[model samples]
Target chain A: MNLRFQATKARTSSLVLVSPALVLLGLLFFYPILLLFFTTLEGENIGNYAQVVNSGTSMQVFLNTLRIAAIVTVVDLVLAYPLAIYISRLSPAGKAIALFLVLIPLWTSQLVRTYAWMVLLGRQGPINNMLIWLGVIDAPIRLANSEFAVVAGMTHILLPYMLLPIYNSVSKIDNSLFDAARGLGAGAFSTFTRVLVPLSIQGVLAGVSLVLVLSLGVFIMPALLGGGRVPVIALLIEQQAGSFLNWAMAGTLSAILMVIVMITFLIIKFATRMFVRGRIDVAST
Target chain B: MPDLRNTSALKLESIRKTFGRVDALTSINLEVNAGEFLTILGPSGSGKTTLLRLIAGFVTPDSGRLAIFGKDMTMASAGKREIGMVFQHYALFPHLTVLENVMFPLEMRKHSRRDAADKASAALAAVRLDAFGDRYPKQLSGGQQQRVALARAVVFEPKLLLLDEPFSALDRRLRESMQREVKQLQASLNLTTIFITHDQEEALVMSDRIAVIDRGTIQQLGTPNEIYYHPRSITVAQFIGESNILEGTETPEGLRTSSGMLLRRASPSTSGRVLVRPEAIRITREPATGGATNQFKGKIASRTFVGGFTIYQVDVYGGDTLTVRCLADEGSMFEASQEVNLSIREADCRPVPQDAKDAGA
Candidate 1:
């Protein structure tokens, strides 16, 4: 009886310690998601959803946002992998320097970073001024308030996020593993492809998922750097809620966007779980 | 490429490895024969693992040459060297099943996957693990993981096998059993093996020749019997087995003890110190029955009774202690502070080896 009482006491204390974080998470994050889903069901008769779903403008905005997110994610990975390798190979002092450099952009507000991109990418920015100076063009190139400008800003904000997780993962890989592979006759490319890349899949998935999910909800970058012409799903929701004052329609479109985002996340999560945990030859063997 | 299995031997000539400022190996030199089981025995931080890693091509030496079969292989890559390594942790890929781990080298050697799988099955069967091919390394016990590591290392048929304290993690029984298994397998396959271990018993039991290493250098190399009975240095005698080394003084009327006892010279004791194995000393009840060259009067200080043998610590005068290995079945009369006569023949003791001076220096 005393043993049973002690066991219960231990479990009760463990649950108590975990309860505060769980409560905060449920209220702050999970509650809003639940409410968002409930509002989708609350509006009278699929009428609000039908209006948002049938709108061609909403469809175009969704595609445009998706295209930007996909392109940015791919480009970000290409730039981040080498930088991650550089950081992972650095000495302790060099590592400190690399970490400071990576985190420096994160210190300021993300919106301010996007505005910095605006100064660099504007019509008379350094790129055009350089081109004019070099006699490559007669006039300054029209650069700002375009899709390119929004992509530039989004990439800048999200590049460090992708680099850090990958750097941490790559750094933890036992260097002897690469030596072992090479000793066993694996060429450089094969070693990287088979061993290094597979081992670092957790970081790849983390960086990809973080960048994709974060870019989907991006508002200020598109609103400020991107002219009002290049409309995104966030812009559409703003139009519906602020201008049309159609809260129900905004909620329905948000539900659709949330579904799309969840589908992408499900694919990534399922693939990552299989990539890391699934026996590489579960069925074939 | 060098023929690693050719009848000659592996020689590391003045091999030196330094990382930036720290010297890991300094002017190291050694030779391992084609099929001989040579163990690099050392305590931790003695650079034995670094030496193995250098030969395995995991790290390139900063200077000097490594020759296998008369071909200089100092700068050769690991794939070209074909040295198989068994890690202390076994290092079986956690994600791979037992059979897949064995087949990895075969696949790396460009064998067809189907053929590799068949050979892997045979290798696993050799280690008596055929029935466990479906289990991952983590699912197996420590002994099982060690066998899988063995199977993985041997499946490729590498000419040289390097084991870095492979059995340091097993229980005593398991270690003994695995040591027997590894010795039998190595003899059957005729593969040259270099085992690195700090455990003296494991080295004595498993190695045909044990190389005692200390502070990044080989102190002595000899057979187990030779190392135990005829040790070169005090360190080797102490490291390999129990012994009693007395610091002698050359005085009038022969080599005498600190407490005015006369002992006959053994093998020209010009060197100030002499080493003697504990078992070589003969303890008898009668004082002058035999014409023993050396004799001393002492009292048993302590008796530790192990099952097979009892070790007696005798306090000899002039502040020197002597250890005696008595057989459990000796039926010898002995007790604490019991006055006894200790005698050793002139043939059993000698001046410590020259390497002992370097070790001391």
Candidate 2:
């Protein structure tokens, strides 16, 4: 009985130690989510969800969000994979410099980065002028305020998120595995495709998951670079709450996006588990 | 490349390698016969590993020629060299199963899928891991992983096999069994094998001929018996086994040790150290009657029972301690401070050069 009382006292002291952070999180984080959920149910319960799901424009916006996110994720992966590999193979000082370059844009303000892209991708920007000077284009084409602009901006902003995880994974591979592959009669290209690619799948998956989710929920990049031509779920949700003053529709859209994000997270988690199973979970003998 | 079955499997001519300011290998000239099991043995930081990498075509020699099966391959890339190597950590692909790993070399050679599977399974069976072909590398124990690595390396039957301290990570019992298994496999396949290791006993047991390396050069290269019984220098003697070297001058009768014991042996050198292995010295409470030529008196300083043999550290009257090993079952036990006599045959007292460079200097 004395031991049990001591255990209770220990538990109580630990709870007291953590209570302040717990209360802060409840007030600032979870409480807002709870209020959002209740706002979706105000005066209409299932009606708001039904209306959002049934509307053709809302459905089209949702599909557009998925398509744009998929494109951005793919573009970021293609750009990040080779760069990550190159950086991971560098010396310590070289790796530091390369990583610093990759992270500079990520550390800058997102609003500033988007606006910078606007200037660069303008009608008479350097890209169009250079194309005209090189005789590739007859005139300055529309570079900004299009689907291409949105994809380009998001890929630039979200690239470091994809590259860092893949770099970490690729760098942890043993150097001797490369030697062994070549010694076993694998040419340079064959060794890379068979050995390096298979071993670094985990990192690729991690980068894909991060870029995909972030691209789906992105709002500002599409609003500015897309010039309201590309309608996405996030942009539509923002308009519902800010311009239309329709709190119910905004809350319901947010809840649907949150559920989709959580589901995507679970699917990626399951895929990661499947890929890394029996490969990395064994004891390091 | 010519398939010269009778030619030397590997030949090195004045090979040297330097990493920036450090000479990793220097003036290495060696030849390996076909189907010969040669081991490069040394302490850590010796040039044995550098030599192996050079032969395997991983590192280019700064100056020298390397030939495998009569083909000068000094500038060849590793993949074109047709050499198979097993790393110390096995280097098995973690994402590939045992079967897939073994099939890798065959697949690289462009074998059909059915043929690769057949050969891969046969290779797995050779390593006694046929039942575990589907399991990944991480799913296997260290010894099993080593077997998988071995299977993968030899699946395509390359021109030469290089093993870089592959058994260093196993437990003692597992290491012994794996050594025997590897040796037997090499013999059966008639594979020309070059093993690199810092382990003396492992080299002695596994290699038909051993090269002892020190300070970026070969100190001595000979058969295991020759290396043990007739070390050319003090460095080789002390590195291979436990030694009690007595530095002294040569006398008409024998060598007079600096420690004041006149060891009865005709010296090969005027003044040098003579090595007497611990097992070569016999200890008894009383000297034997016949053929007790190099007998000396000493008091037992300590005794250690090491399973079948007991090692006694005897403090000789000449003020130097000589380690003596005797069969534990054959003789009476000697306690500390007990008086004893130690005898060594004249053949056992080998005159050795004092330094590694002295052998050729």
DockQ for candidate 1:
0.38
lDDT score of residue A129 within candidate 1 = 88
Deviation in Å, model 2, residue B203 alpha carbon: 0.8
In model 1, the Cα lDDT at residue A188 comes to 76
Q: What's the true lDDT of residue B220 in model 1?
A: 80
Tens digit of per-residue lDDT, candidate 2, span A1-285 = 699999999999999999999999999999999999999999998899999889999989998999999999999888988898899889999999999999899889999999999989998898898999999999899989999999999999999999998999899999999999988889989988999877888889889999999999999999999998989999999999999999989999999998888888899989888877766556443
| lDDT scores in order | 0.81, 0.89
Consecutive 10-residue window with the lowest summed lDDT within model 2 chain B: B352-361
- Stretches off by above 4 angstroms in model 2 are A1-64, A90-107, A115-150, A224-231, A252-256, A259-263, A277-285, B1-6, B354-361
Candidate 2: deviation at residue A107, Å?
4.4
lDDT of 1: 0.81
